[model samples]
Every structure is written in C-alpha cells, then in structure tokens.
Target: MVGEFCPRLVDYIVLVGSHSTNRTSSSIQTPVILNRFPPTDHEDFVLPPDVALFCQPEGCFNVVGSRPARANSDSSTPVRMPISFVFTLTDKESNKVRYGVCLNFLRPIPRRPEGRKHSTSSVPAVGEMPRRTSDVEFSQLPLPRNSDRRQEDTGLHEKKTQRARSSVRLRTHTLTSLCLITHHPFFTKFRALVEFLHTLIHKLHERSRSKRSDRETVWGVLAGGIPSTTSSLVTRSVQEIEIWMLRLLSAPAPVPGKTCIHLAVQPKALMKPLIFALPDKSRLPLVDFPLHLPIQLLGISRTLRILVCLLLEQK
Candidate 1:
C-alpha cells in the first residue's frame, strides 16, 4: 500500500508540470502571433523586444544577452537603441538597497543655422587665430626721425629770405628814378630860382598883412610915414622869406642818399613861373624887387621838389 501511494504522488506532480507548460506556451505564442499580424487599413502594429525581464525583489540577474545578429542588413543603417546604467539608492526607512537603470539614450543635438555651436570648446580662444602678414610688416617699419622734419623747415626759411631780398632791391630802384627827375639841369637853373622867390614874397605879404590888420593903431602912426612903413615891411618880408627858404632847402629827404633840394627842385620850378606871370598886386608879396627873387625862388623850388619826391617814394 505505501508503494502505491508514492506512484500516485509522482503522477500528480507530472500532471501539474504539463499544465504549467501549456499555459506558458500559450502566453508566449499570443504575443508572437500579434506581432506578426498583418496591418489593417486603418491601424499599424509594432513588434515587441526579443527579450524582456522583470525584477520583483532585490537581487542580481542577467536581464539580456548580446544583441541578435542582423541578417543581410546594411552596415551603414542607423540603429536606435536605449542605453542603460545601474543606479543604487538606499531606502532610509527600511534600510533597504534599491536599484534602478537609467535609460539615458544619447541623441545628437540639432544643428543650428550654418552649424553654429553654443558650447565654449567649439569656438577659438582670444588669441588663437593666425596673425596677418600686413600687420607684421607694419610693426617692423621704422618710425620717421626728427632730422627729416628739420631739413624741411630749413628749406622753407631759405625760400622766405630770397623773397625779402628781391623786394628790397625793387624799392631801391624806384627811389633812384624819382631823385634823378628832381635834380634835372633845366629844373635846377631856371625854374627852381623863380619858385623860391614866389614862395618868399607870398609868405612875407601874408605876414605883413596880418600884422597891420591886427595892430591897426600901431600901424596908424607908421601909415602916415608911408616910405618908412613900406621900407620896414619890405625888409621884414625879405628876411622872413630868406629864412624859410633856407630851412626848406636844408630839410632832409626821406630816402637816405637823396637830398631835399634834389627831390623838391622840379615842382618848385614849375610853380614859380605861374606866380611871376600874375599882375603886380596879385603876384607873390615881395616879388616886386627882382634882385634876389630869382635865387630865392630857386631855393624854394628845390625844397618843394624834395618834399614831393619824399612823399612819392613812401607810397
């Protein structure tokens, strides 16, 4: 009877094994069939992973083997795969070890416009680029020294001095011409003497007339002695004219080498004849006496001519 009981127990174990296998096979087959199922007009299907495993407790287990070999697939075909890494965290409350795999699948960052990059490493540092050839040449060039600038200034000064000398020579020539005209022989001999007398007489008459009119009472006594009065007036007039003439002749001309007489003689000569030709009373005051008048006029002419020449030279 004990032997019979053992056989029955073995039979029961076998029966359970067969039922378990059938159930596992059915479950696995269902997924495969569904993956292989044809797509409907409105629906698409996706295949499941070749291997999958679940962990229910803290333990070590091999979840998958190496990837299956691909058959006749292009080597260059891009593959999409999930990358995983183990992470361990300790549970504080239970003091238990927890394990997880981080599926941090890496993806290439999308290129920006013209493939620009934001990260610092892709760009050059402050001084990494090649230096320009032009810049190197400019740095090697020598600076302009002070001696070059000094030579330019020296040349400019020489040009200025030459201009100044030319102007001085021209002015000297002009002055010489004016002096020659004044001292011409015809002007000096005849015309100059006449002008001198005319100027002298005019000045004397003017002085005498002023004195007589201003001192009428003093002249009233002298008026009765006509001869004495005339003589006295004439004498004074002649003396004053002579003094004025001498002064005019002696006055210096403005240009260094030229004399007053040389400069003024011509103009004075021209003026004398005009004065002498006037009616007696209208003539220059003391010209009625012709004795020294001509010589005196000559002196006056020389003086006036000198003044005019000086004035022209200045202009």
Candidate 2:
C-alpha cells in the first residue's frame, strides 16, 4: 500500500499562497523572491548552499513544508491535510510575519476525538526550572462513551475537571502523535538548531516588543547577531541543516555595517564555538522532518504559540 511512510529526497519545496505578514502597512510588500525556491548555488547535502536563512526587509528568504498524508488511502473519511499558514510576530506591525519556514508533520494527522466541547485551559508557560513529565498522558485517557457524563458531573467542578482533562489530552497528543525522529543523530545539531530558533524568536520579540523608532528599520539587525554566523562551519552547517529542513541562513548580504541592506557573501571566519557537521549516511535519521508538522497536527489557531513553547527549552 502507498500508505506506508516514504521519506524520499525532495529536491525543492514550493511554498503555496505565501503572503506578506505586514498587517499595518498600506503599501503591499513584495517577497524577496517570488515563486522561486532557495537555489543550490553550490553542491548540497540537505539543501543548497544559498539557503534562505534570514527573514529581513531586503534579503528575506522563503521555504515551505507540506502536511504528511497517505497517497493511496481509499477510505471514505480519509485524512486531508490543510496548509495552516504559520507566522511569528516580528513587531506589532509585522505580527503576522511568516516565521520564514512552513514545516510539515512526519505522519498523517488524526481526527479530533468526538466528545462534549469542554473549555480548554491556557497553555502553561515555560518555567524557569526544568519541566517534569506529567504522569497523565493521552495514552492513559479512557475512551469517552455516550454515558460519559454523570448526574452530578455537570456542575462547575466538573467543568474544571473537563478542562484539565482537555489540556492533558492536548499536550499528550502533541507529545505522542507528533513524531520527532527518536534516535536521530541530530541531537548534536538539535541544540544549534534550537539556538538558531531561540535567537529568531528572542530577536524578533526584542525588536517587536521594544519601543524602537520607525527610523530604526533602515539599520537592520546584524547577521553576526544570529547564531552560528561566527563559526567557520556555519557555512558548512547551513548546507547540512538543509538535509533536515528547507533552508538555514539567507544568502550572504553585504557586511558594510554587518547588516542586510547591501548584498555580499560573508567571508568564512572562525569562532570559539563550532557547529558540527551532519553525521554520515550511516548515522542519519529519517532523512527529513517537515517544518510545519506541528501546525498540521494541531491547527493554525495555536501554531506560533506552540512553536514558541517548543522552542522555549532545548530539553
């Protein structure tokens, strides 16, 4: 059956219906590259050498990943994948800016379990200390039945109970259902990648949340401010990370003041920290993990919020 999982190599991903995230701008902003995927200016491992790594005003990059679906399913209520557009807030104005990647789930998303619509609780904030795995999980929930509600279960306390149950189910479903390659040697790269994501989130948040001037837009953030920019292998890691996702760094922009305004390839330089190369084929994982998997698994409603939570801690 074609329903079996296929992690074949995809040379490029076409980001469909990608639009600008600028909500307040009167003038329509154009994407840096229209319709063209990040090109392989040089040889590749996971992606081209010239991957779209950054999302800046002038040198913005684009990428997309689709939802996982069985190609040959014949059932009447077969699973359908929706492209839930995911974006991260760059500022109050650019709150809807695409996070620069459209990722995909590793497996087909399941139907929402049918039951009484209970109020769900707010997602827990990532705490200062490490998170402890909750004992309750989706695997532990008993199947709901027609007689699930009891005589006294309709009270306010029952609503609280139901909300707790719903929150547990939501988190558990995210943990179990979304499949991150369990044994992949990407663990080394995971931190680097997470740091990259962490920087993106923090930097964007800093720029957006802070009271900077509209005049400040001219002098954009520095590529050096982004993670892995200083390492000698950053150039190498960009190619390697592409094997896992769509792209990493945007093409090298000019370094006049070390910003994206001018266009210039960054000269290779070394730093104390290093971005290790991807493991050889003998040690690689499923070979690909979609960037938008969480959005498809859950939905657009909480996509960016959940991603922020996921990127909150490296553990």
Candidate 3:
C-alpha cells in the first residue's frame, strides 16, 4: 500500500511543480497544507480522514483543519495565504535591468534622401555682362556752340575801349583850350594896363584926400600953368605922381604905330606940372638953367621940359 501511495504522491508533486513553474511564468501561485487526514499525533498510523486542501495566488493564504466533516468541517474551509514576490534582478554587463521585453514586430523605417547637385553652366558668371565706360572725352565737344554769346562779349569789350578813348580826347581838348586862353598876347597887355591904372588911381585919390583944401587952392595954379610956393609936402606928393605916370606911360600900348605918349598926350599935359613940383633927382634934367628964377622952381621947370622932349621922341 505504501508503495502504491508513494507513486501517486510523486505524480501529484510533479503536477504541482509543473503547474507552479508554468503559472510563475505567466503570473504567481500559492499552495497551503491543512491538518485533516494526516494528523500530527498519528504520524505512523494511516492517513487521517479529515484533511483539507487550499490553493491561491502568491498573497493572503490561511490553513484550517479541525475534526472531521459531520456535515461540514470548519477546518476544511479554504486557507488564505498572504504571499509577496519582489523580483530584483541586476544585470552586470550593460548595467541595465529590464522587466519585460518590448517587441517591434512591424516593417523597417525609411531614411532621408540625399541633396541634389547643380551644374556650373546653369548660372551666369559676374564677368559675363557687358560694361559701359565711365571715362568720356567731354573737352572734345564744341564749346556751348552759341554765336550770340560770343558776339555779345566782343561788343561789350569794344564799347568799353571806345568810351576810354573818348574820355581821353575830351580831357586833351579842355587842356588845349586853357593853354590858348592864358598865353594870348592881347590878354597879357590888357591885364597889365588894368593893373597900372588901378595903382595910379589909388595914389591920386589918396593924395587928393590928404590935401583937399590945398588941392582946391592949387587947382587954379595947376590949370593956369603956374607954380605955387615951394613946400616940402607939395614936392613929395608931386614926386609920387611923377613916378606912377612914368610906369603907366612905359607899358606897351595895344595899338602898333602910335607910342603910349602920343596916345596919351592930353593926360600927360594935365599931370606934368603937378609932378614937377616935387624935388626929385630922377626928374632933374642934364641942361643948365638961367639963374634969375628960384633954384627949386628952376629944377622943377627943367624936369617938365625934359619930360616933354622924351615924349616927343617917343611919339
């Protein structure tokens, strides 16, 4: 009997082992033994009639086997076992622990295409375009080509030259006129006669005013061609008159043929005796006088006679 039971027990252990490994691969398993047919006190006896079996996953298991099952055994209830399996597998080669495998069971991925290349003749080179010359000959072109502008400049220059020449001619004519007027012989003689007359009139007027009463008394004597008393003042006055008369008569007359004396004869006769009264040595004559008359009168009388002779010669 024991031999037959051992074979059955061995078969049951094999089945449980296979089932546990298979279930562990997919999930986990828990097995529990209960005291029923195999009681602890009757280990050498036959298998107990009150034994129980409990099976669960690897968590929350319990054992229950009391007496036997009259109708129901309290120990025959399913045991609950609390079991936990924490798998900590370490990989030494790549230093990575993998829990499960991820399978990519689809087609292979595609790669990106390579870039295309271009030929050199597809684009134009920088030196291929035609270029315009920046340097040009501007000086060779005809200058502004306006005949009116050239003529206007030439006419303006000629007008300025003519005005300068006309101004010079006008200045030359004015200078020539001034020279002709200043050097005229008639004008020279006329100016000299006027100056002489002015001097003679001034002297006569001064003498007349100084001797007004005496001149009034001597007016008859002078007209009658007679001599008065020989006073020194009368003599001096007469001398000044004589000198002025000679200056007037000596100047050249404007008329050619007649001398200044012939032209002025009446004026000479009227002034001669009045001038003779002065005792001037320049008026005295070279001829001898008769001794019967006073020396002063004779001297004066001779001077008048000499003046008349000179006048006749001049005429």
Residues 1-315 of candidate 1 have per-residue lDDT tens digits of 001111010000000001111211212111111111111211211221211111112211111112211335432221222222232334355443322222211111111123323686555667899555597799998886799778878888887886655433222000000000111112223233433434444455556655553222212221221224444665566456445444443433222122122334335756432221112333432223344444555687775776688989853
Worst 10 residues of 2 by lDDT: 172-181
Give lDDT per model, in order. Answer: 0.30, 0.31, 0.29
In model 2, state the lDDT of residue 249.
Answer: 35
Once fitted onto the true fold, the runs of candidate 3 whose alpha carbons sit more than 4 angstroms away are 1-195, 198-202, 216-229, 251-315
| Model 2 lDDT, full chain set | 0.31
Q: How far does residue 257 in candidate 1 sit from its true spot (Å)?
A: 13
- Cα-based lDDT at residue 102, candidate 3: 10
Which should have the higher lDDT, number 2 or number 3?
Answer: 2
Between candidates 1 and 2, the one scoring higher on TM-score is 2
- Model 2, which residues run further than 4 Å from truth? 1-30, 33-212, 217-315
Residue range 19-74, candidate 3, lDDT tens digits: 12121132222432211111132222232111111112222222222211232334
Query: How many steric overlaps are in each model, in order?
Result: 16, 16, 17
Each model's TM-score, in the order given? Answer: 0.16, 0.21, 0.16
Model 2 Cα lDDT, one tens digit per residue, 1-315: 112111221223322211443322234233332222334422322332122222222222121212223545432222223212222223344232112233221111122334765558654556756555566875687877655555346676787987776643332100001011111223333334434433343344345324533222111111111332333333333344333244333322122222322211122462233332333335532333456676767788788776677899633
